[model samples]
Target chain A: MTVPAAAAAGYSLLVLAAVVAPAVVLESAGDRGGVRGAVGADLIGVSAAVGVPAAVLAWRGVRRTTRAGRSRTDVWIAASCGLVTVAVAASALPTVVLHATTGLPVLDADAGWPVPALWAVCLGAAVVAGEASRRGVLRWLAG
Target chain B: MPALNRRQFLAASLGAVGSVAAGTGLGSQLWPLMGREDLVPGRTPELVLPAGAWSPAADRLTFAAVGDTGSGGRQAMAVADRMARGYQDSPYGLVTHLGDLCYYGSVEDRFDDVFTRPMRPLIDAGVAFELAIGNHDGALHHSDASLAEIDAELRLLGTPARHYTTSHGPVDFFYLDSSTPGLFGDDASVQLEWLDDALASSTNQWKVVCMHHPVYSSGAHGSTPGADELLEPLLADRRVDLVLSGHDHHYERTHPVDGVTYVVSGGGCKTTPVRPGRFTAAASSTLQYLHVDVVGDRLTGRSVRADGRVVDRFELRAREGR
Candidate 1:
């Protein structure tokens, strides 16, 4: 059996948080300054929602305007799916940021407890916020 | 689902089994070739070094290091015996000792009972002992007996040279004479040039520099006088994996600076207080020695006390990302 659409989206949001939060922390590299703090505050605001609401609204907006594909030769149909795929892949920008800026291991016993603790906190928020947004979006679509 | 004939079902089952086996084999082989990606970061398990009471396999290069073991007393014997235990558990090839072979301020007279006697097990097992000059290795002064004394000590220890390089498995160890004038004074140009050239020319996957004085430490005798000015940048620029040193009389591992981890394992025979600096990852004033294992592109080490407790564990990955 397939997972419920809303549940899948919520899980995807939680997964996004799992990726983005550690990237932000590692990018800070134990030297969090004013700029990083600002970035974090902004991140917290975005991560708390997981972006499911916006993605849902965007997907609905496209589906409303575009004609549905009737055959395998539908190029526009593929373009619309590609847009969603790009958005899904973009959720993993955190690991990319970490790889570009630093080389710290994903887990090291010497990195102290703060890092892993932060990762856990991010996951917790992702669960709560992701589920809440997922339900809210489903309720809105039904209305 | 649609029903199938017996021959069609058997054909499908065989195809499924073949696909699963091929996928599993391909994944196992391709995982190593996959470098760090923007999506998934590469990670490997942390090893506790051989001193964690585990033995290294024959494929990897393994070694141990102890410093300030010149007293030739009970503490030294304990350390030497513990080293022998580690060797018996898994025989490593070499012990890179930095200095103070004899606390009597002489190496020739007590070469046997003081040095050889304590390490007899490892010696008999044909494990090589590489030496780097420490303060009391008879290089204290250029006295008439100094040259002969140093020569006799090296000859006895089977390490007939100073400031040389040795390769084992995938690692290259460059032993340096970290003494005063030999490393920094006017006559130091030759050794420095040789080290820089050697580091540049080395083709080993992991490069380690061994010396008597550390380039960075938080112990009583801290870094060697001119190490930062003369040696620190050289090792960092050359991309050395690890720097091993003694003389601090304690075990301290530094936070990597410029991708190089500096370790001070000086608790061989004596204990001294060490304060952890901002750059210090771990520090302890206990009698201990360091055990290192170099496998593939990673180096793992643990500073283990004579009681078999691991005081610190750290690892360094080759910058090549292999």
Candidate 2:
């Protein structure tokens, strides 16, 4: 499940924000629980949709590409995949666990399975983009 | 009836055959390399540096800068702790880690014991544990999330000021971040611009540029020609004083080029062999760090070991009042 670059970047940013947001809230909130919780929940939702797929795609992509062979392209792809994987995992983790422990459905109908849908779209886009970028780079080099 | 039955059976059979072929193809491709790729573990958080802190006075400052020290577990911790104990002053300013704080650029619970827990004292102090991200620090493959998270964590830890200059006294320190793997594009232009600004802005008697990779080295990583070509001339133009780095895990000092000294105090984690390069003034493969002291215009710098013995010392005249 390779993730597209734009989506991956978005996920990376969101994950970092989620982790840092807590600290920021702690710094500024002065003990506002409701607001912090709302922000935290939103961050979790974003992570679930973008972050999980990005990570899954990256890990699988790296594993598949590396095992396939050791071309420079493969290595680069593998790395890209791995990076997305880490980002996805880091961002989605806290909320996923929290939801599960609280007996809340991991996939709620209100969210309309957005994470799964985004996974499909981003993964498709990533494959197309990766190939296109690779070819473009090669073509430019040849010229 | 007979024609319709034949068409339906044929179409269903074709679909089943295609599905089987696809499943088999996927299995054949994915099954073989599972052990090698899946089982090979990422970096485990081992003690790279021991737990302790140190402080240098208003007249003299003591600190350690190290890079590529994310591995070696207990051995790394032992060396770091020994160094920490060596500078067991009442208040230690902090450790300036060049980068590669966590191996594979991801967080691990195991690393807390090895990396974070021990350095709590330093965090407690006003000591600035400055860090710059490394090529490996951003992510294992291409993930920037880990990098962002690390940056976020560091910021929360009160080290948010990336690529800023500070002065203990007469020593003006310029901290810069080199390019990471997928992001920042490996161009030194932005860092160089900041560096140029930092140097031009500073009237501080001594200027020190500290980064992760060595612009000059004879170690395993070798010399970064791009850095030398791009950065050296700028430093020369600015009449900068000292350049410090820690990419290769060894200690090295270069002859003053363009009136600037280059020191590689990389012996923070692992040990690599030292071969003399064109600019090397003193080179050591042993674990060591630099202790810099400033008194008025006379700036004194020393490279000390884990055992607390001075390896190299030099003096540079203050830039202006001299």
Candidate 3:
């Protein structure tokens, strides 16, 4: 399915927002229910918070890129870059650092949602952004 | 491809590799270390709280117990507000938390929001906060970080150790770290030994054991394994009068089992459905706390909701020999 270029750019920005939103939340208040592992509810909330702004930013960013004579392929590539960067960072950093520091890649029950959820969210955001930033999208943001 | 497109393609390829790694289960196993694990603090402190002055024979001991209150939401605030109101009315000197004080595995930065902020009223009034470590508070998992989380919680709340004894007037409280799966099978478990000795040596008229997991519960988390086998004999042998616990997200008081009453008061912030078991004296799926009064030879416990309603009440006389 083709997504408007503007929408694609906005969705990519959401990759950043999805991570930021929860960081702000954890920074502000870090309490979850009894369920172990990633909190599905938190992911839903993050999606809503990031999705709205993503929509707006997609409109603006794609428009700006189109006006500057860029193609839908460019937007897709940019989103693809962002997604990959976040995913790789999310996957590799903790294990490498934890193993180096603590002599173990200690994935205990206490890590819970904050760590994994952040990565899952970024991966999810990337996937969505990648899909939304389609190369064959309509020229809605075309100038 | 242009230099910029080349960079983008390189990133896309890297992400694809990551996806493959994850699919092949290499990254999947490493998912638990998702964030900057180094940033997770491990500095533990020696923070044993000094016991306040109170003579059990002459003075009465009053306090409140709550659990599962780490949400820091309207429900937690409501309970705190009620606790404040309760304090205003009767002025309790201490508030004991049954664990899970910080939910969602909150980092140290959230201590204020998950704990101090909501219980501000009680804290400001000089009411001491004592915590029993919960599963969510870094006790369920086994890792260096988990130990650090336990330390962080201990330091935050000023608990003596994983398990230790503290006094409040005539009542001597023995707190246990029951968050791990096996009550007695902890890698190098000494909690039971400590409890046994602590209970035997107490001079107070009341011996109340506080823990995050229940000794006898019928709620979501039933009785802890080895609780009856390993811990029960000690309590019954020592005439330990009460076992206070929170983990089930509801309120349940058991019928006296071998002269010891087990109570689960886990409805500090949230509630889930709970049906009474045969041993249950009183049970309810409600948001509430337990107000307990310990006088000379009698202890009174009242299950109170945020609306000032007393859902359940029971009285226990001092153990005959103790």
Candidate 4:
């Protein structure tokens, strides 16, 4: 339980440093879309690189805790943390696709459907990841 | 199964409130300092225009020139305000943009913020603008798609072609796309050949050439060696009256090099410190635009600052015969 919690915190911090920090720097430089677009695509790559290992470790820890008969609250907390990590990783996908397909760095403020759709995908990933981990499916895969 | 004590609840609420206050206070203090320099209010010295400089025989051709003005900030608006006021007194048909039209021209959305909004007054007044593509005006360093997007937007904003000419009254204006690889780098022969032909064929009395890169400047970015080497001889041979450029973000007038005057009117919206070089007759880091009136053989220019002060003035007379 402690291991998964630590991994979740570490993953969040890594995402903040790797992805969010550079985006903020580029935005501060200018409101132009070139640098921001390049950075946004790069962020998706970084998230994928960091996410795979984090998901594996989190699944392993969940299996160890569940087999040890930990409390439902403890298992739930661990699962929630894993889901949050997955959510952060999932949110970057639409941005990457948007940049790859149409070279727009930052979407216009009036971009109605795509923006909401991206949020929806992120929410869906969180819910799915949390449910799978809680049902011990992630644990079964790890084993 | 333990409820929060009254003390704990109050303490947590107080801490949250305190954190918010501290964050707000710090942000307020640092906000103004971000991405801005501390400007001191001081008047720039005015340049004196010689009496009876304009020739009576030639028809008057008036225009305003500025560069690096796509920031659409307060300073840009102020400079545009001065331009608008100057236009009313002495009506000018054209506004020559020395590029950096919008920061990171790759972004289509920024066109409205940087170029359109700030210069709305001039545009609404039916003053047409001609652009000399700058480093920031296109995605020259970025991907192909970005480059295409920027070029499309620039065309929509009235850049007829990358390198072209427009004749207005007495002045034959030749605009160069200096930001392109072929022009700025080693393979500049293509543009140079075209420039030579353009200058030689021009029938106008006052031949003026405009580009984004300055041939000679005393500002931060000094001078571009490639441009000076390739363009100077053509300008000298043709006896071009004025060569206008903007890249260094300041105003500078140079002593004539081989019968050609090189002027840097880059102080559109932003400014940086400048010092006079060997060729620099006058230099200022003030935010300014050049209000030039060509009347026959004599070309009189006044460098006007944002606050409506003329910081520099000069006159160039067309050489006798050709």
DockQ for candidate 2: 0.02
Show model 4 residue runs off by greater than 4 Å: A1-143, B1-58, B104-107, B141-143
What CAPRI-style quality would you assign to candidate 3?
incorrect
**Which ten-residue region of model 2 chain B has the weakest summed lDDT?**
B33-42
lDDT of 3 by residue, B219-295 (tens): 77688876788778778999989989999888899999999999999987666557898898998877789999888
lDDT per residue (tens digit) for residues B1-322 in model 4 = 4453453344334444644653453244322222122111111112222222223233668898988876654355557767777876677778888878765234476566566656665676677889888877765653577477657656767678778898988888999878657486555778888988998899888888899889999888888866677778888988888999998878999999998899999877666668999999998877789999888788899998766778899988986558
Q: Which candidate has the top score in DockQ? A: 3
lDDT of 4 by residue, A38-128 (tens): 2123333443444445455555555667667754344544454444334433433333343332313233322333433443444345435
What shift in Å separates residue B35 of candidate 3 from its native position after superposition? 28
Backbone clashes, candidate 3: 5
Q: How does candidate 2 score on lDDT?
A: 0.52
Model 1, A27-111: lDDT tens per residue? 2321121112312333444444444453454344334323333221122222223233322233323333333322233332134
* Model 4 TM-score relative to the real fold: 0.59
Error of 4 at A45 (Å): 44
Question: Per-candidate TM-score, first chain only?
Answer: 0.29, 0.35, 0.36, 0.33
Q: Which ten residues in a row have the lowest lDDT in candidate 3 chain B?
A: B36-45
Predicted model with the maximum TM-score: 3
Better by TM-score, candidate 3 or 2: 3
- Deviation from native of the Cα of residue B273 in model 1, angstroms: 1.1
